[model samples]
Target chain A: MQTELSGQLGIERAVFGFTPFPAVAAAISRAGGFGVLGAVRYTAPDDLRRDLDWLDAHTGGRPYGLDVVMPAKKVEGVSEADVEAMIPEGHRRFVRDTLAAHGVPELADGEASGWRITGWMEQVARTQLDVALDYPIRLLANALGSPPADVVARAHDRDVLVAALAGSARHARKHQEAGIDIVVAQGYEAGGHTGEIATMVLTPEIVDAVDPLPVLAAGGIGSGRQVAAALTLGAQGVWLGSLWLTTTEADLHSSALTRKLLAAGSGDTVRSRALTGKPARQLRTAWTDAWDDPAGPGTLPMPLQGLLVAEALSRIQKYEAEPLLGTPVGQIVGRMTAERGVQEVLDDLTRGFEEAVDRINRIAGRSGPS
Target chain B: MQTELSGQLGIERAVFGFTPFPAVAAAISRAGGFGVLGAVRYTAPDDLRRDLDWLDAHTGGRPYGLDVVMPAKKVEGVSEADVEAMIPEGHRRFVRDTLAAHGVPELADGEASGWRITGWMEQVARTQLDVALDYPIRLLANALGSPPADVVARAHDRDVLVAALAGSARHARKHQEAGIDIVVAQGYEAGGHTGEIATMVLTPEIVDAVDPLPVLAAGGIGSGRQVAAALTLGAQGVWLGSLWLTTTEADLHSSALTRKLLAAGSGDTVRSRALTGKPARQLRTAWTDAWDDPAGPGTLPMPLQGLLVAEALSRIQKYEAEPLLGTPVGQIVGRMTAERGVQEVLDDLTRGFEEAVDRINRIAGRSGPS
Candidate 1:
């Protein structure tokens, strides 16, 4: 089911690729799929602008999208230092002790510092939206909840279709009421922030709850058969994130983390609040294990937890601390054993989709012997 | 794909209904699907024999199966009192306190008391199996791991197919090695004992791991569309448990529990060890919440926990404690909005399956205007 959204946007495949790297996003778009670049990493407007410029030159005129982590309720006038002060001293000490225990040294002088999730703040997302709207972006997707009403109106004025990620049917209904063009029903097996429901149950619920509005099935989807399953569940398309992390065009920055991801299985990932203080499915490492331990001080809420661990995580990455280093991923990681180009992944998805459809047709046509 | 087992067993539909009630099991078989009666509650051999006799008379010559809860490793000579002694005094006190806090009164004199999972003990299971084998049962499924080699050989001697439920491909492979005839890929969203892997990922992985072995997809499966998705993922059939609990034929003594289940959403269940030693999905209630709370004494392992909470759970059920009464249910509980007959559910599944297959074919045939 190439959704109405697909026809309206003039996209080819019913696959939606979500990545943080512009190169990967551009590559997926070129490969006849909709590519959405995650904007949470673009805390600096200049950096996002530079990447969007690259994407504009490299996308071969194919439609591409942008995903911003804009929380619906704005925390007005909250500065970084103000949020930083909210983190407990005990949590600060825990981060330091964890890094020291892992034998991870400090980042080298002049090296880039850790990345903060300050972009999730409403003001920062508004700034990112300002830069994105200036471009020819076809889709503006929100990673958190339904973007603020004014932001949706702004995207609409820029002629960009708006989509939002929802983990439940209740959330999907809210997104639909908030004037979202599409609902991405992200399940428990999804990489980043997710809910308790799995894809098989969540996809159909969201699709039914928000009728007429296109829904993209997310979480636990990596193969063509999965794409077919999504369609059978009434979703118009598939939204993928973890599947693109190992693509050749993507840059995870740490080879050790990359190697670990490649070697990991579906069972190797765990949903823990250790990352960003929200339950995110990620590679289960010593870092996650330490924080998940009952004896350790529990994780802080959202932005606070992200702030507390930012420097420690960067140090682990800088020192190549294999045991402590990890990345957010999903159960589909088991299928991502190799690092292929984005085009190859897209080709496999289409080919698999056809195979699954053919199989189902054959099964449907059969009249069993009485 | 109607597996070789389907033809060999003379089953009509690629649907496996798992229920503890022989009436429901017989009704499912009469409706052209395979029905497997769970033998865990049949602690007495006479009780099981009586049910098997009833199934034989009521099945209308349609073949049915029996599922036993035998652990792979035999715990030699451990009595109920011995296992009860293993539970800590603190845990016992906690159970007492939880029931009292909920104001659950004691069971009336001579009322059927709480059930101990001693049915899971190997010796008890062997007796249950002995009773089951007296009948012409076509399939013998183990709820835990694979049955012992001798048990497999005995079942093989009777020409009964041995199937085992597995949560991961690794466990599925182990079952294959242990002479399992079919593998049930039960995922994280399953009602009873389940693994971390969700059905969407687990079904295909298990299918790939145990190629040529008939695989039944379980967990998060309630609708015909989900059944189609299971087949698309390479499962030979769909194995469902929680879906049957709310059926008209089910005998869940408490109407309060049934009402709660019928009203629950997909988010209303949790994967908690509070029900049993191993993580099992159940309705989220005050009981589960209290057990899951950090302040309360943590749960005891398997039989210990089952033993500690049996009487308290019995008391809650006896008193119809609305807040404390809940049943083991999967995420699919959201779709079970009403109590329906076994035949009606079966018909809906087949019709839905056809609809899903037709939709998939149409989607596959579409060549998008590029």
Candidate 2:
């Protein structure tokens, strides 16, 4: 059904569905290539199963993917409940008091669901994986590290390709060694948990190190010339994440937020762990500034940090008044001025790729068949 | 006495000297990294010989080097008569007509003698080379391409290391194949002729491609982090050019030009072929704009294009009132805010390099011995 992406997923233009909304995922699948639903927000197995079913019905079985944050290294094997318990009483009080101070109401009695990042979290991820396997998902990607051995084996058993995101060539090699199918070399220019290395240097080094394995270049790729340069440096396909976040189909908070992104340039983005408790490239905002302030309490670990402010973040999104609510976005966001449909975006990529190929060939002095 | 450029030349720092003046060439040889006079505007052999002799007298018995343009491909041969003959009378008339339209006067009868790229230009370059060789020059660097085979042989016979400027990995390979001793991978951010690739990408690629040959990363590197990044990416050393242009020792045209450069940012510079009929990055000024204007007479090939506007450029420099007369400078000019001595500049680079090394090692978790 999807000819472009079916042969080699790396060659396909995959639109990452960062939202948990099934409709958005389906729309991306309909546009061609795969769509990936962010699975961290979904709590229950049934809730995830429902979303997966909704996506299948809406897209008529177009292949999509599922993404989860299964970090390999943490403080220890401390269970989710144990980690929750480990959070100091003062910190929890601070969160509640801060929300109160900010005019955001606290959850009603018995509505408070404590958040954690441990074995229970892993179990939830495994359960979601189990549910997603029932559908026609062509790929499954993990955000932080190599998927657990069982997760890889189960996906392989279902004939689904497993891919992982890596910040460096060393990380990419570890993924390849672990039998991962594709390595997404995500550079510092990328949004969401990036490294210090810039895209220009990282891409070629990753490509050279991970020979024979299909690699996708992910970073500040917003134009055809960049895509062409990536291919010239040996990437099989380019993975675009931030470029999609600003599209017409994107479920942004409000018009003001979108306008802020439009006004920003490539240099405006900063890599800070304010939101995710990991170095993630995001638009600089008051929230980031507050976290960055030396006087404030430092950020906590992954899921713990995310859990602490999830409700506050929910309020921020609901109000859409604060300019600091925008999520992870790459440096390429500077070039994304107008809102366009996914199909239009794909067409632009195709045109850019063709032009870049032509330019490169001309420079190489090879006009036709040798 | 020179202390910074010791490894390249075999003299002690006390014996050699490094200065901003062209005469520093002999001082550097007396102290040690064999200082070479920058020959950007030296059009006559007599002018160059006079400077060379002045250096020779200033630093008695010190060896130095001579740098010149020997581009592999130029617009035309260097014989003054042949080049003048080759310039179509219509083109000359057109240039005169254009200058007249701009209310500029035509050059006086003998004033146009030094203009044009001719075989005699090569003869002038050889003359300077021979004059330097007559003294004890330890090196001869062709600022554009591989030194002509005979030129290389002459330098080698005199025990001088021959070096060349390369803008890409392919260009570096060409220099290596031609038996050049050193390959300087100058990135697009460089002030002079450059390719489209940035230093971050070009440095490592050139380092990897030209194995066994020491690579010096040049371009937009004005600090320690950049220098560290270059070495981390496999460069042996850094060949700084733009950073020197704003130093207290630098012989600049006007305070206004220096101020404009100081106020610019890393992104202010643009790579355009407006100056030398080849892509050379510079502060985008009116002079470059006039040539870049799509409606204007398009730039001619090297030497031809340069020859066409030589007098106009000289006038622009002489008047110093035209914004179009901005000199060539790299993106690093943005950080070149304050005036500092050459020694201070060297110290800053050393400090920056140390900090970068420390930061990178800390990130890699290898700050201490394994």
- Per-residue CA lDDT of model 1 for B1-370, tens digit only, reads 3545566778778889999989999999999899999998777889889889999999899999999988888778888889888998988888888888888877778877755566888889999988888899999999998889999999999999999999999999999999989999999888888999999899989999999998999998889899899889888889999999988999988898889988999999988888787889999889999899989887888878887888888788878999988888999999999999999999999888888877776666542221
Per-model DockQ: 0.69, 0.03
- The C-alpha local distance difference test score for the whole of candidate 1 amounts to 0.88
Local distance difference test scores for all models: 0.88, 0.64
True contacts kept of each: 0.70, 0.01
Residue B220 local lDDT, model 2: 57
Query: Candidate 2's residue-wise lDDT over B26-100, tens digit each?
Result: 434443334666654566667766877787676556566656776555435546555545556665665565555
Candidate 1, after superposition: displacement of residue A345 in Å? 0.9
State how far residue B146 of model 1 sits from its true place (Å): 1.4
Worst 10 residues of 1 chain B by lDDT: B361-370
Docking class of 1: medium
Tens-digit per-residue lDDT, A148-235, candidate 2: 8878888899889888888877898998888888778887668788874455546655766788787777876766545544544445
Local accuracy of candidate 1 as per-residue lDDT tens digits, A203-288: 98988899989999999999998888888888888999999999989888888888898999999999999989989999999999
Tell me how far the alpha carbon of residue B309 in candidate 1 is from the true structure, in angstroms, after superposition: 1.7
Number of the predicted model whose DockQ against the real structure is largest:
1
